[model samples]
Target: MALLPSTRAITSSAQALDLIPIVNSITSLLQALNPRNPNPKNLSSSPLNRFSPFLDPNLVTIVITKQTNPFHALFFFNWASNPNPNPKNYTHSLRCYEAITNLLLHHSLFYPAINLLKKSQKLSDFFIGKIIKAYGDEGNIKAAIFWFNQAKAIEKDKYLYSFNSILGVLVKANTIDLLRTLFDNVVKEGGFQPDVSSYTILIRGLCKKGMIESAQKVFDEMPCKPNSFTFNTLINGFCKKGDMESARGKVDEAKTVMSEMWLNGVKANAATHLNILKGLCIAGRSAEAIEYFRWMASCNMDLDAKSYIVVVNEYCKLRKIDEAVSLLNGMCGRGISLNVISFNSLFRTLVELNELHRAILLLLQMPQIGCSPNYVSYCTVVCSLCRTEGRMREAGYLVDDMLRNGIGLDATMYGCLLEGYSEAGNEEMAMQVFKEMIGKSYVIGLESFSVFVKMLCSKGMIVKAENFFEDICRTFPAVERDGYRKILDEHQQITQGSIKEHQGEESS
Candidate 1:
């Protein structure tokens, strides 16, 4: 449990420099180190002997944390644990144990975790909560409760860890009522003190269950100040419940907290602004959301991609394609990496407005923007091109592009293509598409079938249409057959009326 001596950090440097890259390099070496060393205590026999000069607690912890293979992590942990290159012998710190133990438990390496904890004299009640939470994370509430009870019998005053872990377990299980009962009992007993985490878990449960008022009450009653996470939770809960007035109130409170944090020289979590943007969007005040987003962009708050996408989606929903594109271009100018969601928003809006030309251009330009067009991007424009007259050729090109890109078509895309072809009087292409659909067992829906039959009859292909119907209509579901019969019957009536008009013209 003693601090491992840093790499002759015993000595000083002339100027301050970043050693993180060097530490990362050493960690990579340890991660790639073989676990089956014949001499586990000696680093000179292995490739890591070179890094012994750089070995420190920080590097050791990083090495253990980075290894996905627990046995490999254990090997490095063992090799680092040995007293080497130092007259003042030191061992792995408690923080190293936490890092390794967490990694082991994350991978369900329980037996090894227990062994490490016991060997390091860390197998105590304080560490038991981690085990409890691990079970809860895997959705095993019963096992979590068992551990909680085990901790319960050991120490009365130090049961707070077990209590907080159980609260989180109950929250995950959606057992809000039982969690509240336990919370109430704990408070009444007053055997232990509950920390910010305890209150946050209870508030999270209440918020999830739509008990916002109760969550707020707990927030107001909390002895400790709420963290950003606590405020974000309450704000999100109100937003989910469509109580933006309350959400905005919390957002204002969060702003004040952020201001105080700023004055205190604490960097505010950039997500604070993101929560406000989402709340504004949920309240249908997208204009305000856009304004807020622009303000965040201008500031040094350092918001992430999601903040831009949220505003981009809002702009799309408002049919403000120009503003959305402008925001995206601005993001590109700032060297912010964009995902397909940013481009897809534009594609979808353009398609909705019958702007296939613009949509197609955007789809092609996606790769140029350093982002690949996803299925939604191609499907949106391709489906729109199919809807417009004389655009099926372009749709086919896009479909070929999709095939080249290895994107498979879903039934929705197929049906949309069929509808688009039928509506454009491209019956030959429609029929070929139908043949493929039939081969794939993709049944044509009522709307697309009606469009197909109408296109056939309107083009004077009556006999071919009749034969196609008599054969295919029977194969359709009985309900769809009935609907098709009515459609055929109405078209027949219209055709007979047209024949009578032709005869009257001859008589005249």
Candidate 2:
């Protein structure tokens, strides 16, 4: 095809008018390639008739990258690939295969994409790596490992990077033993030199599994010196474990490692200090954590949201609400945006103090500050209101708001609301809540169901209560029907006895 005339200039209006035919030619060519066209074969064939022009690797890239309707382009590509109705006359180019692979991955089209890769005649190391990564991403560890082994046997040198990718999958999959086997034998015995990334992956995996000692051994065995990321990973792992005694030891280790890095001309960054502060906080040494934060600030370290949340949470846990709020204000004043964790910490504390009005106001203000209320925030406030007397109405309003905003109503919130309505003698509201929970397929536990049943029967709705029991039995087939009947009978007797006492008192 000839080049389209430049839109930039054609000397003058007269020359520009002359380029209309060329512009129309380009437009017509694109129109012919439109995948939405019923007969895509009516478009020109390939330059050598090796394939359809639409299936040309370069054209496929153009379709994906330049075309407005890539979905239609993919459909046309699939149509070209189909063996029936119109068999493909040509082989797919490597770029075409890769383009389709990426397209599939973009749409999270994993299984079909894997099948496509597995069924291809030209299985390159690059395609194999993509398959391994796709399987790993989907958390199909078994598939990832299987493909990785195949890649190693087929082409070790070309697939060295695949080993690192496989290690990452194993780490995420939590297959520590298999990870070790691959690292120790396949990676080493296969004559593939394990890089720093290889060591880091193993160390982090072991730390995640609480094999901190094993992580340490791997660190010491690294052929190359550990980088800042490697040190940070180890430090963060120890902090997450939350053992005070072990944390102290890890603290000392972190210091020694920091000093060695300094001697080696690698200065400590904010991440390095943040890990230590988080460690101190988790180890119940909040005072030390605050002091470290102050020192880090004094040195002008850029504190992130995680750092602020940790300190604020520690203060809140110690019942130092004033201190926690002050720190939160300080974070905002310094232009740090509060995240969900930051808001939840203070929201919980205020609710715990029975400061419902203040808590509700803060909850409403969350979105203005770019921190939208999550399920935890809504559930916390709703559950708290449900706990207080004369606040069930307010909790119901919150529930309505939650549903409107697409926030999920979890079992804990439902249980609290059910209990509130039951205690308030609002059988109608309790029944309504029970039905909503059932409609949503929430499993009503025995305790919650008991509360609802007692509420229903006490209000003299024995038949309705019996129906509820039957429905619950159907919902939970494992629950013995006799046990439910026994509960209904007990509530029935209690209601009748109370009614008798009331009648005698009225006559007296």
Candidate 3:
């Protein structure tokens, strides 16, 4: 943040403090005044008498705003509320009242602030708004609303402060249900008219709740002109709007809102509609998003990788994998690249749906679209194929692809390779992968190691199985070597007993 001039100081000249020297003089007098008699009865003895000539609303504002101490501010405020001897009959303006009220609230002196505000008959909507927000800071929603309703019942002001304060608190508290109720009541009352702020706050709350259509509805029927803040809020709502159940009318409705905003002198930019496309995607309305993007293109708006990626992610979630594949191919054609993360989502989805071939094609074509395959991009396909019965060869080919792409196999991938080859009954390939896994100091998991050991023992390669187990125990100290060795010894003993029994039967 920029270093700014003091809030209490005048900006007119180079003066960094209150321009009136008497403000400081009065402040000093106030701080040093009698604690026994807050208002000193002896005027001649009081230094404030010398500075009393300078007491005015403006001077009082300067002094109070500068005070870091709320009590000092209150003292100055009381003195300015009515100066003794009554030369000027100085009165507190709404600004003076605001300064002192804010100062008291800033100090967390809530009770005193309320007392001063009520005693001075200065508890208007603005002051009430501060108190409401103070209660909101305490998470005391009931108190905040009580003050709001109390102010509303007594005062006839349309909502300048209290509404914004209470509504903002409600929005933060996720109490939009109640906020909507109050808004409807205020509008239905007919006597008090809500201003731009009231509409803005409610629309923001609605947007946050993903009630896009409702927020849009509010935007459409706003009685007053929407300001930049309101327009910005509406556009943001369009980005996250969840109610995309509108078959096709939402885009046109958005266009109408934009056109109206343009007519109202809030110029609509073409780039802003990109957010609406995101909204369309978030609602899983892919068809509408495509239409919206096409409309954006017709407006000659330049869309980027992020623009296509948003739709791509949403499309991946749909059952129509073919459309997602088509969109990805089109993105490649446009020279727009997807990151491996995006392709990974597609890969996992396709592989899960038993579309391994399609996933492999996308993986191979990732480079054509300028995305280098990551560990996850290859692992998703390779791991799925390893689990399939007849797809072990395809898994091997993907491992080669992974190596060629400079992506090394971690323990998970290595374990998958070992388990796949072993379960397929390929002794030579299983040995090769085990060697590579060991060379990388990556220990195969106990499950896959068991598969490898059982495969070797079944093929009468018991010595090789024992050597592999020892190698694994050497590298991975956490392996249950003693228990596994006992199992291996039992296998050997069982094989010997069967052979001896068979020989004895032949002799008989």
Candidate 4:
């Protein structure tokens, strides 16, 4: 006896229910609908398409109203909102905002999902606070403020996001007047309570902008006691401004706050120590800075390259070249690599002391230590070579090394070589360098060309100097031609006077 058609269909539907869950296990499958995908053809024959009749809005509304497990209903609603296939009637049909908002209202990932929606330009200003909070978390207060302004422009009713975002950005930017204006506007408009983070950012900004008294007033007037981040920010700000007394006071306040019920978890770190050391160094308190650097080392805080470079620069500036070198050598011994800035500092000091050979040696070590000489480093060594006796060959070798290393030789390098040759009484070599400079299309500014011309005129080669001057005028059309004309007139006067004097002497 064969089964009836209706009985066969009921049994088939029961079997299909077991396969539906397996098919729906794929998460966020809508992302596969991108036009770039090559396989929408595969989805055309999918079993999921057979359930299309059950995905109507009325069915979804019934599920939402009658289902005991709202989670499953919510998932269905989300899927209904973001349909599997574009409707044959419409070009675009996905309700991205409705789906995201539904997820936001019911999901654990409310903030992140809202942010994803905002990034897609699908979220509205109703979620502005959440968006602002997201931006603040990412340290993008400026972007937060921009979006807040956009929201305000779109809708006249100001929200908390508008106040907080503007205040946060102004505080971060340290625009005191802008922050005050925003604060006053928020207060006048009413119903916006400034958070601790807002106050902390403002206090930090004020102290950073050198308004310690104003910062203190804000600190004192806060509704709640200050947290460690607040105190730490102020302390760091004071340290940056070289106000050690205020910095110490803030440190004490941070200690007090940490001991109390609040535990702000923000204590002084390497940045704080480094800032204090810099302030000390600037005040000519090298001994104290060195002591602090040592103390930080004792605490196992790894000193950054800039910290070492700053101390090295201070030593060099004070004419303590040996001390600078010793510090650099000590840093190298400790497996702390020197950066290009530090290496260049030491090289410059050695060059200043007329120790060209030692400077050259240090320069060679630069590549081994992963420090490459920038333009300043090359210029420094070249200038030192030009000044030192019998270093012309070395200077030429340095120039070759620069070219080999792919470091460009600009007008300064050419100028240095030209001046060196002129000073050495090698006028022909100088002319050759000038020609090379022109051939290479280097920017030979008026000052360098004028120097070269003066060198030629001094050697009684007035015609060559005039020709060089004319070539320069042609190259730089915007340059005032009067300066070059003056040089030409002077050369002519000198030449004519010399010839007349010679003729008179011969006649006599």
Cα lDDT, all candidates? 0.76, 0.74, 0.76, 0.63
Residue 108 alpha-carbon offset, candidate 4, angstroms = 29
lDDT of candidate 4 over 1-508, digit per residue (tens): 1111232343334224333332233222322332222123343324234344334433334334443333444444444544556352211123434443444444344454555465556555556655555565556666677777777665556465555555666666557887777776765666556677778877877876878678778877887667656765655555554455655544444334334423444466556566666666655667777777778778878777778888888787776877877887778777887778876777778887888888888777777766677777878998779766578889988888888888888887888787777667678888898888877866566656666666677678888887877776677677678877886677668767888899999999
Tens-digit lDDT string for candidate 1 (270-297): 6666776887787777788888887887
Candidate 2, RMSD to the unseen true structure: 7.0
lDDT of 1 at 461: 73
Clashing pairs in 4: none
Number of backbone collisions per candidate, in order?
0, 0, 0, 0
Identify the runs in model 3 with alpha carbons over 4 angstroms from their true place.
1-47, 84-86, 156-160, 241-256, 268-508
Minimal lDDT window, size 10, model 1: 10-19
- Candidate 3, residues 286-387, lDDT tens digits: the string is 787877777765776656767666666777777567776676677677766665667877888898799999889988987876888899999999999988
Q: Global lDDT for candidate 2?
A: 0.74
How far residue 371's Cα lies from its native spot in candidate 1, in Å, is: 1.5
Candidate no. 3 TM-score:
0.48
CA RMSD of all predictions: 7.3, 7.0, 12.0, 11.5
List runs of model 2 lying over 4 Å from the truth: 1-128, 138-159, 186-192, 242-244, 400-412, 431-446, 452-483, 502-508
Q: What is candidate 2's lDDT per residue for 170-196, written digit by digit as tens?
A: 898988998998888865575667777
